[model samples]
Target: MVFAPGEKPGSESEEAKLQIASKQIVQNAILRAVQQVSRESRQREAGAGDTPRGSFRPGAGELTKKHEKK
Candidate 1:
């Protein structure tokens, strides 16, 4: 499915392509909106000095190095 440059929906040549392209555009918009909302939620949590998804795990190598230094 493709939309030609400068083509508008309902133009005879763009009929089938237009429908497919329009649907794709709407789906992409919805996905982008969802992503934006999720990012905002994470930021708000971080601004409060809280981990957004809970604890982080240290890599085994880093943990071992720290222990060895001790």
Candidate 2:
């Protein structure tokens, strides 16, 4: 859609191609967003499930068998 000063307009086919390219760019962005949201949802579900998932609350904490006396 960018035109230089004193530049002639593009042909119908050129405009059509530009429109198609723009559409593909928008569609790709939408698809990536959808995938990200879905992945986050799965992580949240895993965090809430019985099995430990993320670092927020990873399994039961272990105690060190060796103790140091100050």
Candidate 3:
């Protein structure tokens, strides 16, 4: 629904207040989801530096070594 400039919802009638509140609730939910996604993306990017890429070598005496016959 479109509104005139400087006009507010729920101003016309008592019933319109319910509709206005519902619209506000939906808009707030969408805004929160967008912000959460943006925050997580930034965190992942920042944490990438803690672990180097392609550097996952197993310990010398780990499972692979134990399984080998003497």
Candidate 4:
């Protein structure tokens, strides 16, 4: 997506292309930000001195206890 002050205005097709390009750029930036945040969270967890108390894992399937009746 090229934006120039002196250049001729874009045609309809050119404008659509520019819009798509801009959307993709925004989506990519958001994706990168999310990834960075996730990475930082993992780093913080690793550096913390205290051990996690629970056996539960985020996004992992639920574990059924043997004593529980189905």
Against the true structure, whose lDDT is highest?
3
Each candidate structure's count of clashing pairs:
0, 0, 0, 0
Q: What ranges in model 4 sit over 4 Å off?
A: 1-12, 50-70
TM-score winner between candidates 3 and 4: 3
lDDT of 2 by residue, 2-62 (tens): 6656656764466677999999999999999999999999998886786555546533465
User: What is the C-alpha local distance difference test score of candidate 4?
Assistant: 0.78
Order the candidate numbers by lDDT, best to worst.
3, 4, 1, 2
Taken over the whole model, the C-alpha lDDT of each candidate is 0.77, 0.76, 0.81, 0.78
lDDT of 2 at 8: 61
Top of the candidates by TM-score = 3
Give lDDT for model 2.
0.76
Q: Which of the predicted structures, 1 or 4, would earn the higher lDDT when compared with the native?
A: 4
Q: Over the stretch 1-70, how does candidate 1's per-residue lDDT look in tens digits?
A: 5657887655757577799999999999999999999999999878767544455646623646557755
lDDT of 1 at 43: 93
Candidate 3 has which clashing residue pairs, if any?
none
In model 2, where is the ten-residue run with the lowest total lDDT? 54-63
Worst window of 10 by summed lDDT in candidate 1: 52-61
- The alpha-carbon lDDT assigned to residue 41 of candidate 4 equals 97
Query: What TM-score goes with each of the models?
Result: 0.48, 0.52, 0.56, 0.52
Query: Once model 2 is optimally superposed onto the true structure by TM-score, how far is the C-alpha of residue 67 displaced, in angstroms?
Result: 49
TM-score between candidate 4 and the true structure: 0.52
lDDT (Cα) of model 1: 0.77
Error of 2 at 31 (Å): 0.5
RMSD of candidates 1 onward, in order: 9.6, 9.0, 10.5, 8.1
Tens-digit lDDT string for candidate 3 (5-51): 76687556545778899999999999999999999999989987776
